[model samples]
Target: MPHPNPDAMAFLLSRRSRPAKTLRAPAPDRAALEPILTAAARSPDHGKLEPWRFIVLERGALHRLAGLVEERGPDLGQDADQIAKAASAYRDSPLAVVVVEIQKSSEKIPQIEMTYSAGAVCLALLNAALASGWGANWLSGWASHDRAFVEQGLGLSADERVAGIIHIGTETSAPPERPRPDLDTITEWVTE
Candidate 1:
């Protein structure tokens, strides 16, 4: 029989992502964050491709990206509000881990699987932060997808794109529990 870990199950059931906007300063330094990143790297990768990587954005780097967004927003035909929202995330965030998805060409392994691996890395990073008693949230906005913005600000290559930006910091306020999807509506019991 498989050994049961009630504590692990209980933690998973209760884990909730704190809103990125609600996160505060005094973010984890490199030494403190290394373990979290290491934990995230353990996410599943089909065919052992390890097709994802992390970019740790510290406070100064975040501000730089914020400036890039401010300059590029107008060029992208983004409204003032849209630009503000895009820049605010970077400017306000104490720390943001950019989960970059790299599309590797392979015959045996599909590109779709690599994309999935990148997505999994994002979630794993968020969960790791939360499990370590830190506020965390996974986010991706228009700025994240814009080629110019990503290339100039984050320096992603042609074959790379942002899967998610996982913000980690101290929680200022406890977010209220939101509605959850009912299993009856979303699940299927196919025993045929």
Candidate 2:
């Protein structure tokens, strides 16, 4: 018989991500966040390449990024409203974890696989934070995708990209449940 973990199964079934903007102060400090990071690092990695890393953005780092958004927004062709929205995320966030996807050179393992692994890590980290009794949301905005923003602000390497930015903190209010996918419409069975 397969092992059963009813609580774990239930948690997975009911897991809901809190909105990033709704996350408040009192985020887990470094010592408290280490375990969550450790959990994220355990995600599956093809070829054992470990093609992902974490950058925990504390208050000061978040402020710096917020400032960068204002200073760099116009250069990137972002208008005032866009800049404000982008900057607010960093400016108001209690804490965030930047998941950096590292592209490793491997013959058998494709680069796409590495990118997938990084994405998996992002989900794992988000789940970990949620499971640890913190509100968490995974996000990637226009600024995150901007090469200059990522390179100059976060100092990502040439071969690296932002897979996700997981904002975690106290929940100001429980988010109302939204519509979920209809599995019947999305799933297809295959047999040979």
Against the true structure, whose lDDT is highest?
2
lDDT of 2 by residue, 15-43 (tens): 99999899999999988899999999999
Model 2 global lDDT (CA atoms, 0 to 1): 0.95
lDDT of each: 0.93, 0.95
lDDT tens digits, residue span 1-192, model 1: 899999888988988999999999988989889999999999999889889889999999999999998998998899999999989999999999999999988999999999999998999999999988899999999889899988988889999999999999999999999888898999988998
| lDDT value, residue 42 of candidate 2 | 95
Query: Would you estimate the TM-scores of all the predictions?
Result: 0.98, 0.98
Model 2 weakest lDDT span, ten residues long: 68-77
lDDT of 2 at 98: 97
Model 1 reaches what TM-score against the true structure? 0.98
